[model samples]
Target: MNKPLAERLRPAKLEDYLSQQHLVGPNGSLQQALKVGIIPSLILWGPPGIGKTTLASIISKESNRPFYTLSAINSGVKDVREVIDKAKQSGGLFTQKNPILFIDEIHRFSKSQQDSLLGAVEKGWVTLIGATTENPSFEVIPALLSRCQVYILKPFSKEDLIKLLRRAISEDDIINKKSVTLKETEALLRLSGGDARKLLNIFELVVTTESTTSVEITNEMVLSKVQQNTVLYDKTGDQHYDIISAFIKSIRGSDPNGAVYWLARMIEGGEDVKFIARRLIISASEDIGNANPTALVIANNCFQAVTTIGYPESRIILSQCVTYLASSAKSNASYKAIGKAQQLVKQTGDLPVPLNLRNAPTQLMKEIGYGETYKYAHDYKGNFVEEEFLPDEIKGTTFYSPGESARETTIRKELKNKWGLKYNY
Candidate 1:
């Protein structure tokens, strides 16, 4: 049988594992558990090609448990139950010897399918290990998610990827037969996008395609051997991040046509509707802001609607919201204001709240000058009062400068009218 380079290079023991030292290191969280041979039901969350499955396999072997595997893309509730039944027969309940059930892409499982595993997991019939690229809080059902401890796997760093490449060349039986030199790796690293599997696959392709056994890998050689633009949209790869960036930028730039085109690409590529909708909500606030307050309401509704009505139908809702946001006036004043305020807080660590602004609920607190001499805005003529809200030390700092949009321009005039240059509005 012909096996891929990534599969053949998979590490069977924790000592052979490359990255994720925080979890598998000497004093790591899982290190103690692995040493004692008692593994917990866990949800391994991370990007693609980051060793989630391999880590799960190592845990099962180290714990000396029977291993059962299933892919959520193909398996249904029935398949889940069958595996659980065999696991129950294989070992005792609540024991370290319980079978380890590994489910890849557990986020893809529907509510009913996930519900099927809850009983098996709760009874300790199986030590469930689920791997997901999506956030478990959003994708996994709450009941099932609460039952498993979530361990995040970080993306491979540039140094980590380079170490993996060197290990492959020196250790692989087939590759060691040939003389391979990595003259350059910029193109290889860029193409892999921090994914180890993609990196090795590209490296192997570059090596095997060469006519001679002596392979000298360069940026040019690697790029030429690997096919570019083959994948229209890779949900697990670079296109997932790049296309979303394009889609958001198009909206921020007020190009409705560009926005809809990128949206179409994502929709056709099977990008998660909720993921697309969530970005639109952020753009509505951070990009559109007070320029058109209605944009936020529309974007928020788009999220609620799409989550309820998924796929083919949600695409129309997404297109409508995308076009509306692109056509609306834009502003980043609110976003910048919060950022500046946060920076100020960090600089002036926990300044005391002004006495007048403090609430006085009891007689003892009232005597301490809380709410003393504080003017009520409602008692004023225009339902506004010139009160100092910020700490006295940073009293006159102006963080929010209204953007040059019609609505915000009106707001600028109002602020200038109220404070009379106190904030230099």
Candidate 2:
């Protein structure tokens, strides 16, 4: 039997590895460390199919270090200790080389399970390389996290993915035999959502079912294949990306019907309810910003309610949020405002802050005009005052432009009354 395309194409050397140029490229931190023949205890934080495991294997092979693996999901404290004991025996006292222990899904490990490896890691019996989809700060114990350097792996870009597809077509034993023409790669790429493993699987599926080598793959064919395959909802894979995209777009398009439909798809597919809820909360802030402030409050409440009540019942909480956010007025004014402000700061460099807005904790700062012309808005009628708060270079520059929505109408009115043409109200 042939190996899976993802497994077959897994890079065995640093040169074969794609993406993550920052880590494995020339003069990169990992590449530099490899040149010195010193491997640090580290964590690979990223989405699935980005080569965390493959990178660990390459590191161990290239460095000539003994390698051990433990799954945080299935391995216990005893398994951890046994691996440590074996590593110590292999290293001995005089040996400079240490075994590399790679823990997959390290976030799933309990506090006690993680604690078991701390001693071995601290003693240098083994170099720890942990992989996780979650933020290490929240999932990993502080003591263990502090000892290991965390390297983030980004999703593959379109070019990187196209390169992988080309490589698979020419290199893979099974795939190379098949003559296939990729007529439309957008559907395949969109379906895979930057996951190489998922991409290859879909490619293989499409080719295997076709009668000829020169078969053209279409979006319809891809959809039919995916619908037939009823695989588990891999929260770390394509499904996660697809569902979230649908959810966000549904709210953005103001289609409560579509939003609820995607929400149901996620729920029926057994997606992590919390994960869906978290996306909803982010969507509220990002897509529904300012236009409907209540959207965020409701989304946040839905997240809390889903956490308190799990499964079957939580679907209702999710539905309420999806519908409410979809029907509400939508705007990204706050989000765009921050982006504009950030760009201005970068282009203008760090302009000196207005003296009136600066703190005057010391007498020297006050003598330099710090807080000298500051206006206290609270001391004025209706807590309103026209004062120059921005840096002198950007005194009247406007960042936020309120959208033409009901909630923002009030904001537009207030700004028009206060700053008038300064804000182009």
Candidate 3:
């Protein structure tokens, strides 16, 4: 009997794991700790198919620890206690050693289930390795979370996914013998959306279905295969990234028609309407700042409406927001300003706060010249007084260059009127 694709390809060691070089690479925190035989209780947080389970297995193997497993989806408090009892019995083998208890989908475990494991973990009877696709801050109880170090696993990069596909074709027992030619891989990679398991599954389906020895995987073939199969639209997986990408690009390209079309795709795919609305809210600020400040307000209101009302009715609210945002004049001045300001901060190190601008909460600071040279803008005419606000090391450093748009034109004119050559770049 052939094992499942996911099972066959699971990385059994750190060397076999594909991405997360920052964590599992040589000299990485996890790798170093494993070498020294000091494995901390940890929580692996990431989206599915990014190899969280594989990492947990690798940790247990490399450390030579007795490993026990549980699933939050199926395991209850009774199961947790059973595992804890087993771990306690196993810990007696060595004076200093304890068993490693790994819990998959730990986010699904209820408060009581998690509470049951606290005593075992606190006593060092077991080193808990918890994996969750959800944010651990919200799902994992504070007490349990505080006991474990959380490591965030990023989605696999394009190169990483490609590497895995090549490995599956060349290394896997089932597909290795068959000759396959990857004519076009962008569509496959894009469709997979950085999910290694999904990439391999799709590859298996494509290669197995074809009759010819040398198979060509094309964009059309991929689309056809996906369409033929049950359209499993994962809100937290590939479809989430793809739909959101299309939605953002539509607004950026100023095509309300395309924007609304993607919006419909997401809605039809059973996407969480609130998730769609949340992305729109972000697009308003990041992609559509200043040019239409009202866009943010409208997007916020749409998000609120979607939260209060759901389903078929919320689609209308989302449509109104998507269209308005796509049609609005767009600028990223505020976003750009922050980016530039952050870069400046990193470049110049920390500069002393200007004396006049410093708050004189204490008499000692006031006597030394805090607020000494300050001039009240409101006290002056038109609430206009130009003085240095930046640190002394970099005074009058211009960061925000307003983009040319109807909305920003007024801002540019006002800036020129007030600061003249000081800010007129």
How many clashing pairs does model 2 include? Answer: 1
lDDT of 1 by residue, 308-402 (tens): 88989999999999999999999999999999999999999999999998999999989999989789999999999899898889999999999
TM-score of each: 0.93, 0.81, 0.73
Q: Rate the local accuracy (lDDT) of all candidates.
A: 0.90, 0.86, 0.85
**Residue 230's lDDT in candidate 2:** 46
Q: Cα deviation of 355 in candidate 1 (Å)?
A: 1.8
**C-alpha RMSD in Å of predicted model 3 compared with the true structure:** 5.0
Worst 10 residues of 3 by lDDT: 230-239
lDDT of 2 by residue, 1-425 (tens): 87778899999999999989999999789998898888889999998788999999999999898999998767998999999999998774334479999999898777789999898888888899999877898678999999899999999999999899889888988787887666678878887878888888888877777777776667888778777874722444457766779888998899999999988888876666767887888889888899988899999899889877878999998999999999988998888899999999999998988888899999999898999999999999989999887887887788988998988989999988988777666
Q: After best superposition, candidate 1 residue 258: deviation in angstroms? A: 2.6
The order by descending TM-score is 1, 2, 3
lDDT agreement of model 1 with the native: 0.90
Question: What would the TM-score be for candidate 3 when compared with the true structure?
Answer: 0.73
lDDT of 3 by residue, 293-410 (tens): 9999999999989877888999999999999999989898889899999999899988888899999999999999999899999999999899888886776678887888888888
Highest-lDDT candidate: 1
Backbone collisions counted per model: 0, 1, 0
